[model samples]
Target: MTIQSDRARDALLDAAEELFARNGIDAVSNRRIVEHAGAANHSAIAYHFGGREGLLRALVERHHDEMARRRRELTEQLGETPNIHELVTTRLRPLIELLDSLPKPSWRAQFMSQISAVPSAVEVAKEVIGDADLPDDLRFINGAVDGIPEGVLRGRAYLLGSMVVGVCADQEAKMNEDANKGSWEQVGRFLIDAAAGMLGAPVTDPDGAVRYPSVPLL
Candidate 1:
């Protein structure tokens, strides 16, 4: 694509990200996204992203790349047999870093959180992320949670993912509203601690027996 075309595509993506973050995905219209992009063509979104789902998928793909890369880097830094806290921190650090790096308040974190909370949007995000490189931290974290039953593991994973997204979304909103500085670090550490505890928690048997982890909690 030419310079102008590329700019138009980016503008559409940027506009959609902000609009979806603020007003929600279903509430925003294609015409509105195009207008927000300041493009004369009303079909800019359709032309660039096919539709809302496609646009959201693109945004998720981009964000996942950054998050995955950061996770991979953190995992590589470990000496071996990394602690659960470190493993969990890999999940929180990327977005916190991204939030810190942004020059102005961005709707990207809120956008991702909104999509993640929705089943359909999550499916789209999963499809996009599935195609990208999976991080080693995934394996590390799974191994750490091996003591839990498969059903419980799945539940905890869902809760943990939702919590991270929800917390980050709240933090993003706070930063936008109050210009809070360096506030993410404390929350990031708190999430790390909470996730590590949840993942490492003892498993109770269906027969009313509780089996605690042999490893001590942080």
Candidate 2:
């Protein structure tokens, strides 16, 4: 595609993100995105992105890139054995950033909700999250608690990974709620505290499994 075409595709993706997030992904149409994007041709989504799912994938890819960059930056700030706060915040900040940076939080939540409920999207979402660009973040996390056995560490990381996904989805979960309760920073700090207190260390239980006590955070 030409540079102009790339620019137009980006515009369509931006519009689709807004619409799909505000309305359900099922509710938004390709024509709507094209119109919202101000492209003269409504077929622009097809011409540029192939289709709706393609556009969604592109937006997700873009968001994932930003997520990875932030993760790398956070990893750099964290030393060999980051404390609970660093570990938790490093994991939580990027999702918060993704949600907070979007122009249409409500719509984004709707889109996320649809994806969460959609089985097809769920698998892909898991893959997108698991194949996350920064393996070093996991390495650092595993290293931070190097005192635990390898078997124990694997289980703990899996559990912690589950909690992190819940935390990342929090923004969408709370989309209808009032934001007057706190700033984005306050929310991030809360997740950091709770996650740090709960999942950043090894479990002492017989089965060696731990449950994060907090509810979901976006």
Candidate 3:
């Protein structure tokens, strides 16, 4: 449609993102999303997206694409054999950058919080990510890291994902509240340094005695 219409669509997506992040997919409705978006056309949701499901899918796709893109870029920079620190850094930068970019970081944090705790929302996120057809570059970068044991890879990914999720979910707020400085760049570097010891090319700290890796349950 027109530029104004497209802008309205963006507003709708932003609003939907906010609502879903706060209350989750099931709780948000078109009317509420449109209202939050400040769209004159109440039908904006349906006009741009089929409906709630479509909008949710789009939202997931947007975030997932951004995440995957950053992951891939990092993977490429590391070549085919990233060490534990490199792998950690690669996976981390995207989430941190995303959190840093948000105008209302709390909204994204709330949405991610729901993903881990809310069953349905978690399932939806999984589906969208799975459907993204992400390149095997992730697997390649991960493969290069021979430090972490094979068995722990699953768990590491989970914990790593959780750390990223936690960062999005009020971690920034908490960090800010604690008077921490630096933006995504600084936090990303910190994560890489902090996590490299846990998983890498030759493996530095597998047991994770020092910090927790939120890798998923297999």
Candidate 4:
């Protein structure tokens, strides 16, 4: 792509992310995105990213390499057998760091939270993430955790993602209101502790019968 087209594409992504974060994703129209981006062509989004689905995929893919690299660095620091806390940090800290690195008033976290609720958008993000293959650190973390029912583990994993995104979005919004809400490092630490606790918690059936089945650490 030429430099000019690349600039337009980035501008569109920026405008879309802000609009989607402030307003509901479904509430923002393509025309508005083009207007916000100040692109001369009304079809810039379609021309650059195909459509809304492609745009969302591009948004997710935008940070994939950096996040993956950060995770990889954390994973490399792990001992042969890392504990749940270390595993949780490896899985989540990159996101917090990414948020920290962004300019003030970032919408990436809120955009992710919004997309998490849209099934098609979530699928698009998963496609960008290539969910078919689990990362080695993730696979190791999943295998290391024992004595939890597979079902419970899976449920907690899903909840963990929701919690992280929700909390980060909330915190980001709060920071916009008052910068004293807290630092991203604090958020990261709290999330790591909370995730470690949730994943390591004992699993019990409705009747309170303890169950032991392995769960993935996604």
- Cα RMSD (angstroms) for every candidate in the order listed: 5.7, 4.9, 5.0, 3.7
lDDT over C-alpha atoms for residue 105 of model 3: 44
> lDDT of candidate 1?
0.71
Superior candidate under TM-score, 1 versus 2 = 1
Candidate with maximal TM-score: 4
**Model 3's lDDT to the true fold?**
0.63
- Would you give me the overall lDDT of model 4? 0.79
Residue-level lDDT tens digits of model 2 in 1-218: 79997888878877887776566676777888888999999778878877766676676555666766787798788776677578768767897777677663444544555565445555555555553433444465656654654445445555555555555455555654554545556767776777666545655653555433211212
Candidate 1's residue-wise lDDT over 1-218, tens digit each?
99989999888888888898998887888899899999998877788888778887787766566777887798788766777788777767887787767656678778876685466776776677652232333455666666655445445656677677787788888888886664777877788889889877887763443332111000
**Candidate 1 residue spans exceeding 4 A from truth:** 131-139, 179-182, 205-218
Query: What would the TM-score be for candidate 4 when compared with the true structure?
Result: 0.89
Ranking by TM-score: 4, 1, 3, 2
**Stretches of model 4 off by over 4 angstroms after superposition:** 133-138, 206-218
Task: Give me the candidate number with maximum lDDT.
Answer: 4
User: Worst 10-residue stretch by lDDT in candidate 2?
Assistant: 209-218
Candidate 2, residue 184: lDDT: 58
Clashes of each: 0, 6, 13, 1
Cα-based lDDT at residue 82, candidate 4: 85
Order by lDDT, highest first: 4, 1, 3, 2
